[model samples]
Target: MRCAVANTTVMVRKYERMSGRQSWSEEEMAKAVAAVVSGKMGYKLAARTYHIPRSTLQRRASKVRYQQPDDPKPLMGHYRRVFTESQEKDLVGYIKSMEKFFMGVSRRDIRELAFQYAEDNNLNHPFDVNTRMAGEDWVRNFLKRNPELLHKSEKDYELEPVNFDQFYHFMCQSS
Candidate 1:
């Protein structure tokens, strides 16, 4: 099928039914663990009520009971959130608002702004200490993520004065 709005062809695939365990959301995990901890409900009962796996709820409840000092901190295993999700959304909003005033931010400008935001917030960013700027890759990924931000380059053209009448007169005289 062709999608007119997107101007692209969409493929329809047959729906396949697969049996697997469903993933639990943060809220669901917390609620299930809390219910089990409250002593009014058992792990199996709470899991059934929350529509989550009993084993998963049991694991979460155990973790909550025996939480270590470092467990409270956010896990920075793969990627560290230099800015929280809300902060990043705000940054994107600010950049987009600038476009409303005919002001376009370049990739470098965004990088600089990101660095300044991190520094001001004292966030532990992955940017270099010497350069004090976010990486080029980060800027590229940011642009990729926000496709609405168009990169428009303002061009400066040099205008040279030309006399068409003088050229016509010179051509007539020469002929």
Candidate 2:
């Protein structure tokens, strides 16, 4: 029989013609076992030479069973919220009121108020408290939601500056 190795064929017939009932000779078994025991050759290479699967060779080589490492833990943090239509309207109203009370409030304050009102009424709003940018954002959103407020300051006489006598007369008339 011929055995092929690296494109070279060597003639050897001692272990090539074994029948189905035939078992490995002591010499062949010893050489194969010694090669596996040496640990220098990888199990896949050894198993290929001996005509067995790498997994079976590995199982026969060691007694302990193999197990995969545990999966990593999920990230730690809060989830975002999904507001209903009514809840969204309420939030818009609250933000508008806040804008009317304090012009040019920071976005951080608006975001905090969103979260606070949500929490107070057992709702969920998922804005981060520590990182909101306020400056122009607060005014932009407030105006977008309450566009009438912009006209109030621009066209309404109530927002105009009045003399003390006129203011006194208006106050007295109202009282």
Candidate 3:
């Protein structure tokens, strides 16, 4: 009978299935290997021509040794710290000591002053001049420790009345 589904007029023949012998010739295998090794055709193209998977071709190709170019060296540079602990402490102390003279001075002013002090004293501190500003922690700690330094006047605040108990309480509560 003819098969109508595939539009074929050939007669259908049925029989027990049998395994076929390998038909791949040595010449064809050799040609495929040569084409892949040539480097002119990519392994993918070679695989397509040889009716083999690209990965299989790649594995075969990988067995061959190919020299790769050396990688470029990375750029070298130094990273200097902005401030040391000792420098930070000195800066904090300087600001606290000069608070009466520079009461209305902002953090920026304090930092500039610290920079000037460093420059004047020829202090070989590793702090970047841009980041030497005293923060609120420094001010709070300084005030807490030296409570007698907290003196309020109608004109300006002065470091006079050293209140130890009040300072201790303030520090404890804050902590």
2 or 3, which is superior by TM-score?
A: 2
lDDT of candidate 2 at residue 147, scale 0 to 100: 57
Cα deviation at 119, candidate 2, in Å, is 0.7
lDDT for 76 (candidate 1): 55
TM for every model, in the order presented, reads 0.45, 0.28, 0.25
Best lDDT among the predictions, by candidate number: 1
Give lDDT per model, in order. 0.67, 0.48, 0.51
What does each candidate score in C-alpha RMSD?
21.0, 22.6, 22.2
Once fitted onto the true fold, the runs of candidate 3 whose alpha carbons sit more than 4 angstroms away are 1-79, 121-175
lDDT of 1 by residue, 1-175 (tens): 9766756887869866576667568898888888898787898789888888998888888877786443324545875456666778767866664444434555655676688777866776898778767998888877776766655542211132223234323433553
Evaluate model 3: give its TM-score: 0.25
Residue 80 shift from truth in candidate 1, angstroms:
3.3
Better of 2 and 3 by lDDT: 3
Clashing pairs in 1: none
- Candidate 2, 54-157: lDDT as tens digits: 56556655532232133122334742223444655665655454445444333444445555555555643344545432234443554475555454443343
| Clash counts for the predictions, in order | 0, 1, 3
